[model samples]
Target: MDFVEQERMAHGIPSQGKITITVDEYSSNPTQAFTHYNINQSRFQPPHVHMVDPIPYDTPKPAGHTRFVCVSDTHSRTDGIQMPYGDILLHTGDFTELGLPTEVKKFNDWLGTLPYEYKIVIAGNHELTFDKDFIAELVKQDYYRFPSVSKLKPEDFDNVQSLLTNCIYVQDSEVTVKGFQIYGTPWCTIESIPSRCITALYDNCSAQDRKKLRRVVNTAQRITQTNLPSIDSVYTSRCLRQAANIIEDPSHPGHSLFSPLPSGRKSLCLKARTTTLKDSFYPAVIRLLNGPCIH
Candidate 1:
């Protein structure tokens, strides 16, 4: 493929209005099959790209007509509590525990049965196994297991595919729905490998395993890298020593900003509040849009 064709392929774009190519009937090439099918049997519709009218910087806030319900980190606890009804149901992350086949089936079953018109879901750290590549492979193979060469179970892959069929799974991407630009990320602080049974869960750093994990880490870092530095890094650098000294002068109110901990620690004050680990936004949206409560 030339540069233009390679660029198109990189973005999964169709070249020109139409393109034609011939291939042998016995060809087992997946790309060839897709291209061939697209050339004849498939009809491609150009995306609808609408331009929104620009609003003045000082324009007044629009009337609060639309309600948005956000939920996150459900981790496969659907039936434990009733969901609040809303125009949109947003489940932010950790849709299932371990991202297992059975868990996904139950999660999808519950999500599909919801009364909300729009249901959006995102994956979280616990769903480490449910990456886009894994999901795509599962879908392509009709949720079957890899042959003896790979140990990934059939049930696991199939379940992921099944769940994806009904719900929108956002990876390192964004979707526009009802004037909102929704971006999703499934990342969290890395946990120490607690168990060795599932190699995916922990770092079993053999030469091959190191290569695999390094690739995964590098890809993830590039995908989520941002131009801005964190507040701590910007403030504590040696290059900012003069500025830091000025800011931390005795007369400065910021002098105590980085002071050592007090001799006696204070006890944490506990409040009686409903704590939600996942889908925290879903219920809030339901309460706002579908009235204070869905149940």
Candidate 2:
């Protein structure tokens, strides 16, 4: 409702020492659902993409075609949502309410039910618990802003990343699934989130981890998720442009940065080494698209 509330919820700050799941918003009409980003679908010319009905569950896909389902910013409110079938499930970020262990377990339980062969996930800005360094820094460093945040104990959130047992949790790392080099990271540019107070990933990463961080753009056969803060439409395109300018590269075709709202496709590109798509980070229904990959 208010900017303070939005900021608070975005950071998973508890209202009264307890975090609650926010309702996920979905775009009723399909087109506007893609808020604004730099990824152009025309470049790859996907074989086909069926968004509205999702071709029904367990439907057949063409041979050599791999369907990828991308979703983000669910915020731990996936109770009634209907899921589509795909070979790989790429959840960009924000799957939990507060990145709490209980919330992570709930999200993990849902992941367990999914029939997808591979499920890859990365944390979003909302994953306050998973970004334990951010929490420690907040409690120790920031002076004026984190009055409530300073109250959070680092021990409660330590090893929070471990709760994600059901899916491949990748932060500044890569996992090769079915020959596709899928890398996931929560690294946000200072330009992307200018208001950011804590340097989460940059401060936490080791010297070696920083090396992998630099390689993010160059190493993606398919880099699945990026959580960019939602700006109004007038600024969305510009913000996305700023992000793409840094992430996109003409030399390496495999590097693409995709995130929900902030994020799919069929036949996507049989040989499309690098592809980018933007889905509205808020809505879940319209956010569901087939990420077409091959086996």
- 244-279 per-residue lDDT for model 1 (tens digits): 454458886544433322432221122224544112
Q: In model 1, what lDDT does residue 275 have?
A: 48
TM-score, cand. 1 vs. native? 0.40
C-alpha lDDT (0 to 100) for residue 17 of candidate 1: 44
User: Which of the numbered candidates is closest to the native, going by highest lDDT?
Assistant: 2
Backbone-clash count (model 2): 11
Query: Per-model C-alpha lDDT, please?
Result: 0.49, 0.58
Which stretches of model 2 miss by more than 4 angstroms?
A: 1-59, 140-151, 195-295
Q: What is the TM-score of each candidate against the true structure?
A: 0.40, 0.47
lDDT (Cα, tens digit) per residue for candidate 2, span 1-295: 3333443444466444434554324223212324322146454322332134335656766544567888999999989888777799999998976676678889999999888999999998878777766678667865475455556676677888887888999998999887678888896542344223212223334567556544543343134344333323323344334435533564444233233231223213222222222222111112222333233
lDDT of 1 at 125: 53
Please give the range of 10 consecutive residues that has the lowest summed lDDT in model 2: 279-288
